[model samples]
Each structure stands twice: as C-alpha cells, then as structure tokens.
Target: MTITEELINKINVCTKCSLHKGRTHAVPGEGSYNAEIMFIGEGPGRDEDLQGKPFVGASGKLLTELIKSIGLSRDDVFIANVVKCRPPENRDPLPEEIAACWPYLDQQVRIIKPLLIVTLGKHSMGRFLPGLKISDVHGQPKRAKGIFNERQVYLPLYHPAVALYDPRKKDILFEDFKKIPLILKQIKKSKNDIQ
Candidate 1:
C-alpha cells in the first residue's frame, strides 16, 4: 500500500484531539495518488461534517470553479484540510487542535511529495509560511525548505470561502488562480531541462 493509504487509515481512527469527540466522521482526504499539486485548507465545515468529506459546502463549489479555471479538476489534484474534523460553528481551530492534527498533515506531505502545496486560508499559511499575512502574501510562491526530502514549493492563497462573502475577493482569487497553470508548466519544464 502507498504511504497515503497508510496515512488515511491512521487518520480514519484518529483521536488525538478533543474535536474527535464531536466528529460524526473523519475526513481523511482524497485525490489522485500521482497528483503533482495538493491543496490544504483549514478544516472541515458543516457540510463536510454531514457528508464526512472535506470541502463539500458552497465554498467547495467555488473551489471547483477555481480549479477549473486553471485547467484542472478536483480529480486532477489532491485535497485535504489541516484539521480533519469540523470545529464548532466554523470557529478557528485551537492551537491544541492544530498540534494534534499536524503530524497527520506532516505525514501526508511525505507520502504524496507533491510538487507544490497550495495553502487555502490563513491557518494553513501559518503552518507552511509562519508569520506571513494572507493579505500581503497570497499568491506568492515561496520555496519552503526541509519540510520533506523533495523540497516542495509552497504557495499561500486566500481561501475560497473568503471570496464567497465578498465579491471583489472572488475576482482577486480568480486572478491568482490564473497563475497555477503557468506555475505548473514552469515546474514541468524545469524538470525536463534538468533531466
């Protein structure tokens, strides 16, 4: 079995945090095993809690459109949240919750070894790019060193949910989404030139 599968199994039975006590189902994440891009969001929301899948709410629909704009689909990339369970009323996940859930995300990064990790929200941006403000830094791709052996690229982005409530943010997100295709192309071309 792949590392992702192993990690999924472990996450399915995770009880490291108090959030697990209220969870109806664990969102272990899902996507292509060979996906080059991985999207990491903050946590499951209400719709997610009901369906036991990550990003199933209206935000997810917007996310789908964003991915489609970049000439990709959900099936083309992997998706997961920083926290697998829903926090109460969509409140910010506590530091302890992040602590309890971090190892799983760490393990995921190792397993997939994605070419790029796109953080969708401030919290996820915190883990990858500490002390970075979402307003100033969204859409900026920084090469994060020493996370996994592969030296993955990290791109902090505003979450789709933020755009849902604000129309102008949606336009900004679309503009940022346009960058994905070019970025992926650069990575692909670089690899070919290297070889």
Candidate 2:
C-alpha cells in the first residue's frame, strides 16, 4: 500500500491519545490521493466524531461553499485535522495533543505532497505559519521549504466555524477564497519559470 494509505489505516485504528477511548471513530480525512491542494482543520466536532469524516458539521457546509467558490470540491482536495481525534466538549486542541498527533499529519502531508496547504483554523494554521495569530494573518500565504523537497504555500484561512459564530467574517472569507485559483496558477507558472 502507498504511504498515505498506510497512514490512514494506522489512523483508523489509532489509540495513542485518550481521545480514542471516547471517540466513535477517528476522522482520518478524505479526498484524492493525488490532490493538488489539501485542507487542514483543527479536529473533530460532535458531527465529525460520529461520522468518521472531516468537515461534516455546520462548519463543513461553509467549507463546501468556500471550496465551491474556488472551483473545487471535497473530493478534489484532501482534508485532515491537526488532531485526528476529538477533544472532549470540542475544546481547543492542547499543546500536548497537537504534539502527539503531528506525526500523523506530517506523514499525510509527505504522502500527499500538495502544491499548497490551506489551513482552516488556528490550530492547523500554526503548524505552518508559526508565531502568527490567526486573526492577524488569516488568508495571508507563507512558504516553507522541504515540503517534499519543494517549497509549498501555506494559506491560513479562517476556519468555517468562525463564520458560524460571527457573521461579519463571511464577506472577507469569500474574498479570500478568490485567491485560491490565482495562487495555484502562480505555483505552476513559477515552477515552469524555474525550468
């Protein structure tokens, strides 16, 4: 099996964290193995905990609309959480939790080798855009080297859940998503220019 598949299989049966004991399932993530882009979120919610899938709650609906705005679907890109298992009461993933589950996320990223990574929340955002506050830098893109031996753009987008709680962010989010198509094109153009 491919590395991603093996990682998924292990995630499916993971019991490393205490979350596994209470979870209905481990939301490993889903989408094309060859996806050009990947979406990373915080962790499972009540809906996701029951469904064993990422982004299936109200926030998920917003996520779908955002994805559609940029001419993609959940099937076209991979989606995973920084933490595969849900924290009790949907609390923010703690530092220890994040530290523990990063291996899974790291392996997934290596396996997917996405041209860009769209971080959907602060937890996921901090992974790539360290030392930055989500409110201050959401939607701004940064680059990291050695992502599969190539630089990859990490776009920190507000989590859909943000829109769910605060309606004011919706317009800005739509505006931000407009950048996806352009960013992907630029990535290809830059690659060719280097050649």
Candidate 3:
C-alpha cells in the first residue's frame, strides 16, 4: 500500500490520544491524493465525528460553496483537520492531542505535496504559521516551508462555521474565497518563471 494509505490505516487504529476513546470513527480525512490544494480545519464536529469524514456538517456545506466559488470541487482538493479524532463536546483540541495527531497530517502533506494549503481556521493555521493573528493574514497567501517537504504556499481563512454563527463574517469570507483563484494564478506564474 502507498504511504498515504498506510498512514490512514494507522490513524484508523490510533490510540495515541484520549480523543480516540470517544470517537465513532477516526476521520483521517479524504480527497484526491494528487490534489494541488489542501484544506485543513480544526477538528471534527457532531456530524463529522459520526460520519467519519471531514467537513460533512453544516460548515462543510458552506465550505463546499466556497470551493465551488473558486472553480474547484471537493474532489479537486484534499480536506483534513488538525486532529483526526473529534474532541468531546466539539471543544478545541488540546495541545497534547494536536501533538499526537500532527504526524499523520505531516505525512499526508509530504505524500500529497500540494502547492497550496488553505487553513480553514486558526487551529489549522497554527500548524504552519503560528502566532499570527488570523485577522491580519486571512486571504493573504504566504510562501512557507512544508511540514515535511519543500517550500509551499499557505492561506488562512475563517472557518465556514463562522458564517453560521455571525452573519457579518459572510461577506468577508466570500471576499477571501474570491482571492483563491488569483493566488493560484500567481503561484502558477511563479512556477513558470522559475522554469
């Protein structure tokens, strides 16, 4: 089996953290292994934990709309979370939980080698570009070293769930979503220039 597949299997059986104890299924994430873009979120919620899939809840539907607005489908990009298993009560994942689960995410990044990683919230953004205020950097694309490979591009955006809770953020989210195509274009141009 490929390394990604193997890692998924390992994640399925992982008990490295207590989060696994309450999980119905460990959402190891899913999407095209060859995708050029990846979307990472914080962790699973009610629907996601039950379904064992990332972004399958109400927030996921909004996320799908955002992806569609960017002229891409879920199949065209990978979707994952910082923690594979859902935290109890959908609370934020603890530092220890993140530490335990990050290796699998790192491996996925190495295997997929995506040119761009879109962090869906502050938690996911912390993995790559920690300490920066999401308000200061949302919609801004930055070049950064990959978790396990060469330099890659990163974008931080508010989680789609934000719209559900606060309608004021919806327009802001859409504006950020619109920047994605432009960001991809620039990345493409830079790659061509380097060649």
- Per-model TM-score versus the true fold: 0.92, 0.93, 0.94
Q: Write the per-residue lDDT of candidate 3 for residues 1-195, one digit (tens) a residue.
A: 977878989999999999999999999999999998899999999899899899999999999988898888999999999999989999999999999998899889888888789998888888888888998998888777777655578989999988889887878898998988877887877763211
The CA lDDT at 16 in model 3 is 100
Clashing pairs in 3: none
**How high a TM-score does candidate 3 get?**
0.94
lDDT of each: 0.85, 0.85, 0.89
Error of 2 at 160 (Å): 0.4
TM-score of 1: 0.92
Backbone clash pairs for candidate 1 read none
Give the CA lDDT, 0 to 100, for residue 59 in model 2. Answer: 94
Question: Is 2 or 3 the stronger prediction by lDDT?
Answer: 3
Candidate 3 runs further than 4 Å off: 148-150, 191-195
Q: How would the candidate models be sorted by TM-score, starting from the highest?
A: 3, 2, 1
Error of 3 at 105 (Å): 0.2
For model 2, the local distance difference test gives 0.85
